[model samples]
Target chain A: MTLGEQLTETSDALLELILAAEDIEQKEKLREQFDVITESIEKLVKENVKKNSKEYIAVTHNLNAANQSIKEAIDDLDKIAATIMQVAKVVEMLGKMAAAMP
Target chain B: MIKKITVLTLSLIISGCGLSVTQREAATRFASASTSVGDFSAKEFAAMRDVTIQMNTKDIALGGKAKINDLDGAFDVDDVAIRINAAIALSAYGDLLLALVDDRQSRDLRNATMQFEDSLRGVSGRTLSDADLDNLGALVYNIGGFFLEQQRAKALKQIVLRSKTDVDHLCDLLIQDFNPTGLNLLHAVDNTSKRLKVDADMALAAHKDNPKSKLFAIQAYRLADSQRTRVKKTGAQAIAVLTALKSANAELVNALENNSEFLVDTRLLGVKMKNLGLALKVFSGS
Candidate 1:
């Protein structure tokens, strides 16, 4: 089990023990300790999962590269579309020339 | 001789169009489904932060001791921005994929071809025969569509190959971030909310003698229970969507690698994304 999971299981066990404690002072002491353990788990989890870690930075870089490659592909497709239109324009010119001849 | 050459070229273009029709459909579906996943994640992350802050407020009201540190985690603006930005980048990547394969350009070419055919009728006082006009339309469509499809297939192949590693890593990282068992964001939120629930229960136990105090404690526990449910459900949906995206992307990459026409069955990914959307709408009430 992960540290978070282990800590959580321990915390739950502690809470159950607090419920079972017969002495009021002991119950209060266990509750305070439970609070501390839970907080430590939260802090540890947050520290372990850094949002701006190096891996995330690398992902951002990869996305930039992918975006550039996609942009180039779109540009190339646009040029091909232009060529298709040019072919149509040439065909139209040829038709008009033939019509004007006879 | 020129007529024969023209006929052969048209034949080649039309045949090329047939080759990638299924692949094109697969690329389009992958793009749409993955985009939905990205958009879902970005919204979920922002909502998670808001929910954490709301829970923290309730924590302070319930006399919980760890409010300040938990609230600081929620308010880390730069960290949240990085997470949200990465998700938006993912959405943008999917959009670019769609742009590469969508038929908007070819549709425009069809419109232009019709206009050109209309102009020819007025200028020469000689209307082309219906068959001639039909052939002209078919030729324009096939050539335009073939080139576009061919390029789309090539670009899709290049992109899937080049970006596969990064996409896999990002999706896996997001899944772990939302994982319930790990030392991740979801775990931190779950811990805070669980602590609050415990405090609520203790409050209920402590005020057993006074009716008014008992009523207040009951209401507090209910509030804690409701918010905890929301956080858990939303976190689960985030993980589901990211998991679907990772599998879908890997399937797409594998198809491309094999140089096969059939890419992937996006039905499962589509259903997962739709479910995530429904969960978000219900949880956020918006």
Candidate 2:
């Protein structure tokens, strides 16, 4: 995939992570990590990072390689996602118990 | 040969006079930029404090029900404290610059500048000689064209150097505190999010076993979700503010660095002061 395609895919994944985040704490953590990556991108852009720059080429190449394996990695996350939803359900149930108490 | 020497000396003196004009313009530009940095820093810190207060309030309310600890205390207090300190330093520095340039109408400013200078000397452990002090007083009192050439240059250079040092120190202090405060804010937001998630999960579990309590469980989950979203949005804004502040600090430092126009003009002023010294020596046959 091209660099633009990879970035688009990365952005989608990040959005999913943010939406699925269990609480504001988790969302903040995810955003902070995202900020670090974006800050680096900003610096590179400011420096006029050229297409021929070895680092840029290497990063795009590595990301493309990593993209192939991400589907399997996401499959693993499904199990964790199920567990989190279950926990959320349990917390909702407890809130009912507390409200019903004297 | 005598005529040639006389002409050369006259040209040097004329060039030396021109240096004072150049130095005054450059010093004015530097002071204006430095004031902007101070104003920007103060405004950013105040904004940070406001955001921190909002987050802290949410955290406190959440902590009453959840297992979250308060991580925003330090930031909530230090933000205002640091901003006030920066304002005072900037004001004193501005007063000193004005006292040097403005006429006798700035009498109160002159006294304020003297007090600030004394405080700075106490801190830096540097003593001005009696003659140097007299020259400075003369410069402050004789606002317009009534000063010796070398004394005026010396006083201007001294004031510029002191103002530069003060602004640089303030910037250093701001930069030093910024990173840790940003991190603390992030941590507080993160913890609050986590605690809300756990609370929502517990409420969900209780609702599973108690059908009559379904409404309560739904309300609890909704509240937690909304609070979490609010904290996340605010935390993101705080991060952006900090990023802008860091950039401002870097720009201020760059303007004051040795290669910048401000410092180059200052060096030119030093050269002019030296030329005046040489003229005095030649005329006095010393």
Instruction: Give me the candidate number with maximum lDDT.
Output: 1
Model 2 chain B poorest 10 in a row by lDDT: B140-149
lDDT of 1 by residue, B1-286 (tens): 4345447657776665332555566667778876776787677677667767876776676666645665746336666677777778788888999887777777878887887777666565555665575567567766686777678678878887799888878888778677765667667666766766666666666767878866765665666566666656766877877776777777677666664554444547777777777876786652
Off by over 4 Å in 2: A1-18, A21-102, B1-19, B62-72, B76-79, B102-152, B162-166, B178-286
Query: After superposition, which runs of candidate 1 have C-alpha atoms over 4 Å from their true positions?
Result: A15-26, B1-7, B14-19, B123-130, B208-219, B259-265
Write the residue-wise lDDT of candidate 2 on B1-286 in tens digits.
4344444544555555322443554545444444444454455455444544544444344332322343333343543554545544454444444344333323433454355334333433234544443444333323312222333344445444434433444444443333222223233333333334444444444347776455555554555455445444433433333334333333334443332333444333334334433433333321
Chain A TM-score vs. truth, each candidate: 0.73, 0.36
Instruction: Report the poorest 10 consecutive residues by lDDT, candidate 1 chain B.
Output: B258-267
Q: DockQ scores for all the models shown?
A: 0.56, 0.01
Which docking category, incorrect, acceptable, medium or high, applies to candidate 2?
Answer: incorrect
Candidate 2's displacement at residue B4, Å, is: 19
